[model samples]
Target: MASYKLYYFDGRGAAELARLVFKQAGVDFEDIRYTGEEWPQHKSEMPLGAMPVLEMDGRKICQSLAIARYLAKEFGLFGSNNMEAFLIDELFEIFAEIMNSHLVKIYYEKDEDKKAEIAETFKKDSAAKYLNLIEKRLKENTSGSGFYVGSEVTVGDLLLYNSMYGHRKWLGKFGVDVYEGRPLLEEHFKLVGALPNIKKWAEERPETAF
Candidate 1:
């Protein structure tokens, strides 16, 4: 077994995908978290002066997306070929864009009322727009099979899993159920969640709030 250690803040913001991947792969690894105070001293030691670093075989890797892709490829979660992997990567990139847009207010917004306003606008415009597009893609990808991107589970599925679930909470806070109008999306979420390995991983891990 490889020596795998994932370093991050004690939240689901960036490292969740990697964690889920490791869990679903039934890999035993160390999960290390740090607080704001501890990060400054630790930051200088990191390769990129950042959190969410994954130390594989004692070699440190940086960047959440890069780490995710590396692990996906390592664990066979990435698609089988270059083109298929590229397609999975493309969808993952799209999810990253959506998360980056809304995460600004999540960590920095201080004013209660203004933050609520921002969340509401984000939900209606950015989040809704992406979900609608994803719903259409999901409907089209349903060529007698339910999975997205390919016939088998891929990195794209995990990326979409995080985005859809993350935004659902952000949307609900604004009185909008993110899945309200998207039955296909709901089914998609359920299918991802019901992946036997993923469901077992989720259940065994301590309940984590994003």
Candidate 2:
């Protein structure tokens, strides 16, 4: 089997979607993690001065989105047509934007009061925009089928699940339970989480305290 080495921080911040995609595809790979202290020294060796680098067949790749799309294409999670791939990319960008904004406030904001305000606004805006969009997408997918993006699971579903899971964990500090009014999204989360492959992977994977 082809294998990969994924280098990232100890937490599941940026690299998690890739991790989950690999697990769902049941591809065996090496997961390399670093601490904050170790990352500075480790940074120069990476392709783009960034963590979350994925190496396959001795070739290194950078940028979480590029790495994710490559893995998804390899694992058959990408949509079948150019149009579908374009749609997949669109969804990926939406989730990425939302996640980045929340992470920035959490990591960069200096004032406690301002951080709280930012987080609350993040939860509201993200929930209102991204979650609602996902809810609509899932409802459309619900024609007696349990897949998002197509007749079967695709990269979009996995990425959305990881984002929702991360948001649920991250927003808890602000007391923003993400599932309060979004029943469709809650069901979507549960549906994706209960995938037999995903559930088993979650059980075997090393738990990272996000």
Candidate 3:
């Protein structure tokens, strides 16, 4: 029952991982959003001048992954042991890096041609370097439950699901589908997306161009 406020642009971006965790944990938090026009005015107030800062009991924290890790610990979503937590973080960072690779280009590149080119390369590189590795990793999880870390859903799972869901929704414009063709990833994506809390949040959460 701590006072929590999450600030982000009006979209399902970085803050969404924590938001989904909150929903899964069944916690109430203020989801403060800003628009492009309003962001600059309040930009100076954000820690690191970045959005997706999580303020808990008036203490502000920045960086999406850090906030996510903290929340995972807070909500018992980190995993049951140190080893579990390690696996969870490992999977989370891998998924985060993959998502960020394309996200930076999609958000910052001004040239449509360049962006398209980047997307093509991203699709190719991701498949070659990551998609198979992740499938093999998922196959190694003891649960064999299509989860990234353990038997129960963890923060890593949410991050993975969010990456795929967002990629499918946001990256399709560039003709890139990060979650395509990998059978285990597809099943993992489906399993996490269909979780009760996540499904509900997806149904009701604000729509964003991202």
Provide TM-scores for the models: 0.87, 0.90, 0.93
Q: Please provide, for model 3 over 47-101, each residue's C-alpha lDDT reduced to its tens digit, 9 standing for 90 to 100.
A: 7998899998888999988888898899899888888898777777677677676
Displacement of the residue 70 alpha carbon in candidate 3, Å = 0.4
Q: After superposition, which runs of candidate 2 have C-alpha atoms over 4 Å from their true positions?
A: 101-103
Alpha-carbon RMSD to native, per candidate: 2.2, 2.0, 1.6
Between prediction 1 and prediction 2, which has the larger TM-score? 2
Query: Which residue pairs overlap in candidate 1's backbone?
Result: none
| Global lDDT of model 2 | 0.79
Choose 1 or 3, whichever is better by lDDT. 3
Q: Output the number of the lDDT-best candidate.
A: 3
Name the candidate that leads on TM-score. Answer: 3
lDDT tens readout by residue for model 1, 64-168: 888888888888888767766776776776777766777476547777677678776776777777777777666766444577766787767877777777667
Give the runs in model 1 whose Cα sits over 4 Å from its true position.
none
C-alpha local distance difference test of each model: 0.76, 0.79, 0.83
Model 3 TM-score? 0.93
Q: On lDDT, who's better, 1 or 2?
A: 2
